[model samples]
Target: MPLSERKVVARRVTLELANLVIKYGRPIVVNLGVGIPAMVGEVVAEEEVEDLITITVESGTWGGRPLYGPDFGVSLGAFAVISVPDQFTMYEGGVIDAASLGFLQIDAQGNVNSFYAKDRIPGPGGFPAIASGAPEIYYAGLFTAGKGAKYEIGNGRLKIVSDGEIVKFVKKVDKVGCSSKVMLEQGKRVLYITERAVFRLTPEGPELLEVAPGVDLEKDVLAKMEFSPIMRREPEQMDERIFGHRRMNIKKELLKAIRA
Candidate 1:
């Protein structure tokens, strides 16, 4: 894919994560942490969702607006910026809800491995800090099945699907970003979403919340997953509106922004 197209995918994926956050808003302020979560901060600022839901980034961008074009705010100001320490304080204080994090791997218990990858590809960032700060943590990534998404079905059973190149959405993570054992002990809420399905951790194991539309064959979803989830009726549609929000309102400046 072209670099330009890749950037568009990144923006769209980030917006999907943010849109989920906006749809599931709480009555209180929700502090969005770094990376993809920060892009959510941009989405909220743009009012593509709702202003009642506040956004704060650990990188000191709070309630910021988006800068148009492929630059991703490279040549423009970061709107509604805040201080680094303040963001951390809010997070560490448990002020954040539903942190949608990107990870190299995520296990059934919701432990994430983002700090490092196989042979140590990606270095650790603030994963531990954010996990500590946020009670309700969600891990997300694109779906794939190769040699990576493997588990012996020791606990129960694993009906394998297409093997993934990277072992994300695995039965057991090679490293510990967070721990399922710890989450079980703490009774914390854990969620996992890929392009294919959504799973949540329970005492029994991972429960299938929903599956991605069109890929509804049990083996197709199961074959790709490391652990077996209780069968669900069907997954939900991501919605066409998610792709086209420009028609929501048409301001002259909005049109000029797109053109310019």
Candidate 2:
């Protein structure tokens, strides 16, 4: 795959993730974790749902329109900025509607291991507080990491360069940064959205919900996970709109839903 086409797959994956989040609708408030999770805010801005979504950061920025890249820590048109402690109060009090956060490793039990992986960065920051409180949690990231995993776009679907040496979906994570067991017991809705598939947490385990086009459910997804997920009888192919090169009219749809 050419470098240019690889870029296309990368962009499409990120946008697909953002679109996935929008389906949950605009919550009264939400927090977006760093990395690809933060990129979702960029898509929200593009979809013109900033007012509807109200993106928050761990740095005490509430109701701030998220700014990606170098301007990430600051919001473009912020409504308010409070102290760190006050923000924690909000998270701990279960005020956030949803929290979209990054993932390193996840297990059958839904435990996440984003903080203690070797050969990668270590730190949970405010992930625990955000995940524990948010009624809905979207674990956002690629399906594979390390090794030589790469992506390309062709035939309206994404192609993998090489299956990465490391598989992110494991039987047990290196450490439990956020306890999926606790969240599941509390009856929170937890989802793992990757570039190729989506899974929902269930009493049994992670349940397969959707898979991207051109991906093999058995070869690409099921084969890579350390534990077998509960396969939906008829798992849906991710929507075609998720692969488009242009921004979707999610703003219009969201506004219409609000009015209705």
Residue 10 in candidate 1 has what lDDT?
Answer: 31
- Each prediction's whole-model lDDT (CA): 0.51, 0.74
lDDT of 2 by residue, 84-155 (tens): 899999898998877888888989887888778776677788888888888888888888887677776545
Top candidate, metric TM-score: 2
Candidate 1, run of 10 with poorest lDDT: 1-10
Give lDDT tens digits, candidate 1, residues 23-47: 4542224544333433444444443
Top model by lDDT, which number?
2
Clashing pairs in model 2?
none
| Model 1 residue 167 CA deviation in Å | 3.5
Give residue 153's error in model 2 in angstroms: 3.0
RMSD to truth, every model = 9.1, 3.7
